[model samples]
Target: MRGWITFAVMSVVTLILLAPIFNIVILSFQGPQTLSGDPVWTVDNFVEIFTQTPVLTYLTNSLLVTLGTTVFGVVIGALAGYPLSRLRNRFARGYSLTLFVVQGLPVIVIVIPLFVVFAAIGLADTLSGVAIIFIAGSMAVTCWMMASYYDSIPYELEEAAWVDGASVFGAFVRIVLRNSYPGILSAAIFSFLVAWNDYLVAVVFLRSESNFTLPIGLQYFFQQNSTDWGPVMAMSVVMLLPPVIIFATLNRYFSIGGIGGAIK
Candidate 1:
């Protein structure tokens, strides 16, 4: 009876969470009949979204920024994380504390200074410029995440590699990096999503229509035209695809495993 009750509760919770997503899906497929406050179904709106909106451009920008942020974040994160994880130095500890504090500073609070600095340096309103800012913004969180992952790894693996005619770099490659794949991929996803979802920074720094990311572009679309619910829902559905794909692609690495494979 308890198990059945728990199952009923879980089913209700799942439906509640999925309701909005289902609404979006239904709304995306809705057509001219749906326009009259009646829920009608058709594929035309989705077709028109592809035909009409500069959606591909916005999607491309999102992809580019996500890729750039992920690479920059993961590479820098691993490098910075390595020292922080293994070092016993006071400076490293102090810097780690400072990094945590910086992470707590919300993105909205920093946009003003970034705008001034980027414009002065002539990086404002450019794709590369957006990417650079995103990299810096994501690096602190990435470093902390990577450091935690590294902490879970045994230092002895690195030591063993060093004993086997390996330099620090070689040991890192052979031992640490091999074990860091899941963590690296996870960090990449986090950074990519952060860059992709950033609206405030994009709004402040990106003035050109061509450079506008999907989030910024979506806002512009809504602002410019009378309410076009069809294309709006279609674009939303497309925009949500990346995070789903990324999480699904990376979820393969996470699993329960026992050392040397024994049932305890």
Candidate 2:
């Protein structure tokens, strides 16, 4: 009875999450004839995406920013987390807590200040400037994610390496990192998702038509087309592609061994 109840609950949750996705997929397949009867499948929307819309450009913009954020965020997170792991001081605890607090606050509260600062620096409407904000936004979350995952690692490994005449940096590079590759991959994936799924900051900072990321582009696509659900759904499918690919490739990293090896 308990197992049946759990299964029923899971089924309900899954349907709630997937119903809209299924609707979008079905809408994407609707023939492009003003939502008329013919129930046939077509690639017209996807083709129009590449050939007509500036979607490719938007895709490129999203990719560039997400990759840049992941690269810098992972580097900064790993570096910050490693040292914090070894420190037993009260200041270390306070510092980490402060970063957590800052990161946990709603980004809306700071958007106005960021907008003013960006406008003053001539960064208010550029893709590069928006990427900078994305990097900053993902940093604290990435740092905390990595710090906790790294905390699970054994310290004795680093201590042994240090005793063998390995410099602090060298020991970290050779031993600590070799062991933490999985957690690092997980952190990188999480940061990438955060940057990729962002819509609010992107909509706020991006002004030029040419600078739209996928989310902002989708918004425009929805608003521009009148009674064009097919194209709208197609745009959504395109947006889903990258994160799907990333999530699919992450199967190896989520395994017990991948996480366990990353820590110890």
Candidate 3:
């Protein structure tokens, strides 16, 4: 009876969470008739977006920034994380705390200074410039997350690798990293989402219309067509797809038995 009650409660919560998503999807299909109280479904919103808008360019820019952030963020996190997990010195501990502090700091607080610096260095209004911000913004959280995950892994595997003539770096690569797939992927997803959903940073640093990301482009679309609910919802749906695809594809790689099984 308790199990059934819990299931009922969870189902209600799920519905509540999914309600807005469902509403957006329905609105994306809303045609002229639906707006005028006739209620007919259509793909005109999608058609309009592809045909009349620069959605593809915006999508491409988002993809470039997201992919760049994920790659640099994950690699840097793993490299920094290994030391934090295994080191015991005062500097390591202080650096770890610094990461937490950086992660906690709001992006808005640092973006203006970052803009000044980037503009001076000639990186402003460029995709690479925006990607650098995403990488920096995400790296602290990624480092902490990867470090915590590495802590859960037993050190015996690396010790054994050392006995077998492996260096510390080799042991980390072959044992720690090979087993830290879930952590790396989680960090990648966080970085991807950060780059994907960023509006404030993108709008501030990126000036050219060609360099605009999906969020900026979506906001511009809304500004130009405030009453066009269909395309607005459709773009929202488009923004939702990459994260879903990423989670779905990487779900299989996140297993529990990589190094733990070998430890015993």
Give all TM-scores, in the order shown: 0.91, 0.91, 0.95
lDDT scores of the candidates, listed in order: 0.83, 0.83, 0.90
Tens digits of per-residue lDDT, candidate 1, 1-264, equal 999999999999999999998888788888666445786788787787688878889999989988989998999999999888999899999989988888889888988998899899999899888899889889998998888888887787767767778999898776777777777887888899889999888889999888889998888877765466877788888888889888887788655321222111
Candidate 3 residues lying further than 4 Å off, grouped into runs, are 34-36
* C-alpha RMSD between model 1 and the true structure: 3.0
> Can you tell me which runs of candidate 2 are displaced by over 4 Å?
1-8, 32-36, 256-264
The better-scoring model by lDDT among 2 and 3 is 3
Estimate the lDDT of model 2. 0.83
How are the candidates ranked when ordered by TM-score, highest leading?
Answer: 3, 2, 1
- Cα lDDT of model 2 by residue, 92-195, tens digit: 89878888888988989988799999999999988888878888888887777777766877777777878889998998888777667677888898889888
> lDDT for model 3, on a 0 to 1 scale?
0.90
Candidate 1 colliding pairs: none
lDDT of 3 by residue, 133-232 (tens): 9999999989988998999888988999899999998988888988888898888889999899999999999999999999999999999989879998
Worst 10 residues of 2 by lDDT: 255-264
TM-score of candidate 2 versus the correct structure, residues matched by position: 0.91
